[model samples]
Target chain A: MRYLKLIKVFIKTSAQETLMYRANFWVSLLHAFLNLIVAVLALVILFGQTENLNGWNLSSTLSLLGVYLIVSAIRNLFIGPSLEALVGLGQEVWNGQFDFTLLRPVNTQFLITFRIWRLFSLIDLFLGGAVLLYSIFQTPQSPNLLAWLLFLLALVAGILILYAILLAFTALVFWNPGYLFTWVFDAIFQLARYPLGIYPVGVRIFLTWIIPVGVITTIPAQVISGQTGAPIVFLILAASVFLFLFASWLFNKGIKQYHSASS
Target chain B: MNHRGGFALIKATWFSWMQYRSFFFVLAFGWMIPPLVALFVWSAAAGEGSLGGFTRGEFITYYLVLVLVNQITYAQVNWTVGDIIREGTLNHWLLKPLSAIYQALSSELAGKVVYLIFVIPVGLLLAILLKPEIQTTPINFVLSLVATLFAWGLRFAWGFWLAILAFWITRADSFLALQDSLVFIFSGMVAPIPLLQGSLQQIANILPFRYMVGFPVEILVYDLSNKAILFGFLMQLTWLAIAVLLSRTLWVKGIRHYSAVGG
Candidate 1:
């Protein structure tokens, strides 16, 4: 309840900043729209030359694209922006500004994550929904309510894994406090856009185990489209649970290791 | 100003880039992976048959060459220019004896050189593993290099002008992001021009984006007629001229606006 109140205050403070730069919202929206168009065009050209990709047709691929877009939009909307601020705590530590943050009454993680917000990033969520619906329309097998529930379940699991993976990356900053380590993570996430089946076996292993984007994107699509069994979704849910706990523990440990600039 | 000065700036830039060699190595891999993923996808889609005149091996060759072309021509000038304007660091460049364009060019050339150090080794490994079909003549190789130089020039200038928009607008980086979307769409990053249907193909033919990266890759991978290669060069030159004009105009106007209001 306290955290909720804190976040409400944070949002109210951020709303003014977001409103001042209204052009940014439109620009970001256009950018997202254009990126989706390119992605669709790529699929169109691929399907033009051949009907199916490893037994996946245009509609199936479009659905996969939709999941990628929506998942990323959700990340940008809250998870990504919030955790990015957590990563910036390393800079604060280096500059001796972290002591002030740490002295706050609230949880350090909560304060770190909720300090700033970019409401403009939410534009991607709408566009992602549109693309998802467009693909759902194109698909011959329309998902039932139960299927959507399953898809949403898998999506939550996928999103949790993404957040966990990204959180672990940010934790490294507390130890290093110099290089922008998040950029290395940035290099890998774009790979999440494609289905893992397209990659070779070795890469498939890496994406599944290390980054986990393969599971994050593919399992959701596979479940939603009825391409795979329900058992797979259960497996992913279990893995996501484990990853979330592991990442949180790692982040706390890293925070403990942080020696402030003043010290 | 002089040969020694220019060479010294290039040398300094190259050595500075070497400081982040490890980062560039990872980043080069990141840049290379998307094209490789596309190759795998297209090759899988092709299966036993050709798609849009690209056999599986041909698709492999096209994407592999594209990896090289895209890396060389990729300009991060917009980010730099945006930073310079936003931070009011243009004063430093204005005080310098050399033009800002030369500084941008120096950094760009150094980045390419540093990036290629990793990219060439990776390219060789990919070539050996994938065993791409190459239809390169000595003449075509030389012409491709010339075309690539023009392509880089055109891209660099295009980004430089876009960056100058930061002087007029609060968030010019969004425009660059938008331009990146168009470049991805029309520059044949997503698909070959032949694969682009109807109006899209015509847009690619006329747009500056295609010449920035794709035209050179097409020359490298495809057996084009002499007339076709010549026409591509003409288009590249035309775009270069326009980009140059745009950059010069923007730089002059942006400087006047900055000076008038900066105080």
Candidate 2:
């Protein structure tokens, strides 16, 4: 019940903070829309060059790009801002701000997780949906009910995995207060821009097992394109759950090391 | 021509970076990731062959050179300008004997010098390992040097003008972000402009984005015809002149409405 109240407070604070900057809100929305347009132009250029690139047709590639953009957008909406905030939190903790957070009758991890949200990032969600729908309309092959269900399932799992990864990276601040790991995390995600098939087998293996960026977008794309089976879906789900649990454990361990500036 | 004050300021900025050497390294490493990833992807696509008339070695050389050129030409003036406007820091600059732009330009140059230690060695190492197809002609080298200087001036002026837009809008970061996204697409960060489709390629050529990085990098890596090289240099100078005139006009006008907001 306390956790529910904490979430409510976080949402309220975030909304209020966003409302404070009306100009910023509109500017960020326009920025996101421009990014979406650029992505569309890129797709058009890619298809214009050839009907198929490396055996992936225009529609399939567009579907993959759509999934990539949506996953990336969702990550930016939630995890991205949180990660940046975590860096600031790391600095603040080093300078004794953790004491303030600890004094509150709220879970520290939960407080840190949802402290800030760039509400304007919802533009990416709308843009991604539009692109996906446009691509589906143009495609001859239609995904059935099962495909849709599995794709949504994989997507949720992917989001969980991404959240876990971000949490784990944030928790690293306990050990290395410098917040240098953010760059590494960003670089790992950059690999997801292309379909996993374009990468070598070794890279694909590393991304799947080590970084799990592949699950963030590729698995969902595969499901939507009807390329994967139940086993792969099960694997992704299992990994997502494992990662979340592991990251939670790490966060708890890190919290114990927190030394309040007040003391 | 009493320039001692300006020289001292530039010297102080350079020395400050020396005191914080690790920060420069961290920033250069952060900046290198995107271009490095692009190099790998393009290399993989070329795959012991050629794509769009660019061999693997040529692509590697092009991007390696691009990294250095981009570092040298990058202007953070917009960010600084926006900060000054938002934080009321511009009042200090306005009171100083030197123009605000001189301070911004000096700091940017100092940053470039600091970044060189990290960038140059890595660039040379990559060039040696990858063996990028570069034309080693005296005239080409001279032209590259000239193009880089012009590019720096053009980018700095352009960024300064964009920063001046903060006088009109509080949220200028969004516009800067949009400029960066355009740079990534049109400045040959993803791929060569020539490799893009007919209309996209034309658009890239018509814009100053290509002159900012691609033109110099291309001149270094490939044997451009005399006509093309001449036209490219002319275009760079033309853009630089336009940007300088616009920035000068905007700065004069922006200061009139500059009601410093916060500190």
Candidate 3:
């Protein structure tokens, strides 16, 4: 109950801070919208040139693109901004200002994570939803109800997987107070632009097992396209849970190594 | 005197970058992926043959050269500008004896010098391993060098103009991100300009974006007639001139309205 109260306060504070800069809010919305348009146009151009790139047809590719945008939007709206804030917290800790955060009765992680909600990323989520729906409408064959349900489940799993990955990356801040890990994360995320099957077998396996970027968008996309089965979905869900737990463990471990600059 | 000052600034920046040896090495490793991935995809598409007029060897050469060209021409001043505006660090620079633009240019040059330590070795390894169909003509090489320098100037000026928008908008980072996405598509980062369809191809040809990465890379990989090469150089110069004018106007106007709100 205390945690819930703290979360509510954090959310309210973030919303107020976000509203203080109205021009930034509008520009960020317009920027996200333009990004969505560009993604859609690129897909349209690609599909126009070839009915099937590699083995996947237009509808399947579009569906994959939808998943990519949705996953990216969610990351941007919540995880991305939160991770950035966490990094700032790390920086503050490095510079001896963490005492202010520590003095508060609230959970430090929760406070740091929810401190600055980027309201503009919500625009990205909305645009992503619109694109996903539009792509669904354009597809000649509708996915069954079960498939849609599975897609949602897979998306949840994907988000968990992404969160786990980010948490692990952010944990590095305890050791190195800079943007190194963030850049690596960005590099991995760039791979989500295309279906994983197009990559070499080694890369495909590495993305799935090591970085897990493939699972964030591709595996769920495969499930939605009806290219995979129950076993893969189960494996993905289990992996997501395992990874999250592992990341949590790592975070706790890294915190013990944290030497506050104030000390 | 102005030209000499500019040259000195560039040289100073280069030397400063050498001081942060470890950071530059890490950054170079981070940046190597995009071009490497592009080369991998293009190679796969070409297989044992050719695709869209580019053989496997030609694709390798084009992408590797592109990696170098992109490194040399990248304008990270946009990122710095956004950061300075957000953090109110611009005030410190404004108070300095040197122009903030010169400082930015110097810092950028320093980074480039440091980055070359990594870029050069990896680029050479890829070139030798792949044995790409590279053009060794003196005229093409000389033109490419000239075009690349002009392209860097144009991109830096354009990015500086965009960054100055932070004076009016806090979340100008979103616009920069959008610009990056557009450049990825239009600047032949993913695929060559010739591979794109009719209208898109024309847009890529006419836009300054192509000159930033593709034009110089094209000069390296293919033999263009003197007339074509001259026209490309002219286009690059024209865009650079426009960017300089835009940045000058924007900077003057933005500083006039610069109400430093936060530190």
Badly placed stretches (over 4 Å) of model 3 are: A1-6, A88-92, A96-116, B2-12, B21-41, B47-49, B81-101, B125-136, B161-181, B223-227, B245-263
Native-contact recovery for every candidate? 0.63, 0.19, 0.25
TM-score, predicted candidate 3 vs. hidden true structure? 0.86
Query: Candidate 1's residue-wise lDDT over B1-263, tens digit each?
Result: 55567678889999999998987777777777767777778777777788877788898889888998889988877788788788887787777788677788788889899999999888889889888887788888888888888888889888888988999987888888889888877898878777888898998999999999889888888888889888888989998999989999988988888852354
Which stretches in model 2 have alpha-carbon errors above 4 Å?
A1-9, A50-54, A89-91, A103-106, A200-206, B128-131
Residue ranges of candidate 1 with Cα displaced over 4 Å: A88-90, A110-115, B1-3, B26-30, B260-263
TM-score of 1: 0.93
TM-score of 2: 0.91
Ten contiguous residues minimizing lDDT sum, candidate 2 chain A: A45-54
Error of 2 at A169 (Å): 1.3
Q: In model 2, how large is the Cα lDDT of residue B51?
A: 80
Greater-DockQ candidate between 2 and 3 = 2
Write candidate 3's Cα lDDT for B160-246 as tens digits: 999989988867888788788878788888677778888888888788898888998888777667787787888888888999999
Task: Give me the candidate number with maximum DockQ.
Answer: 1
Provide all candidates' interface root-mean-square deviations.
2.1, 2.8, 3.1
Give me the candidate number with maximum lDDT: 1
lDDT of 1 by residue, A131-176 (tens): 7789889877798998898899899999999888987887787877
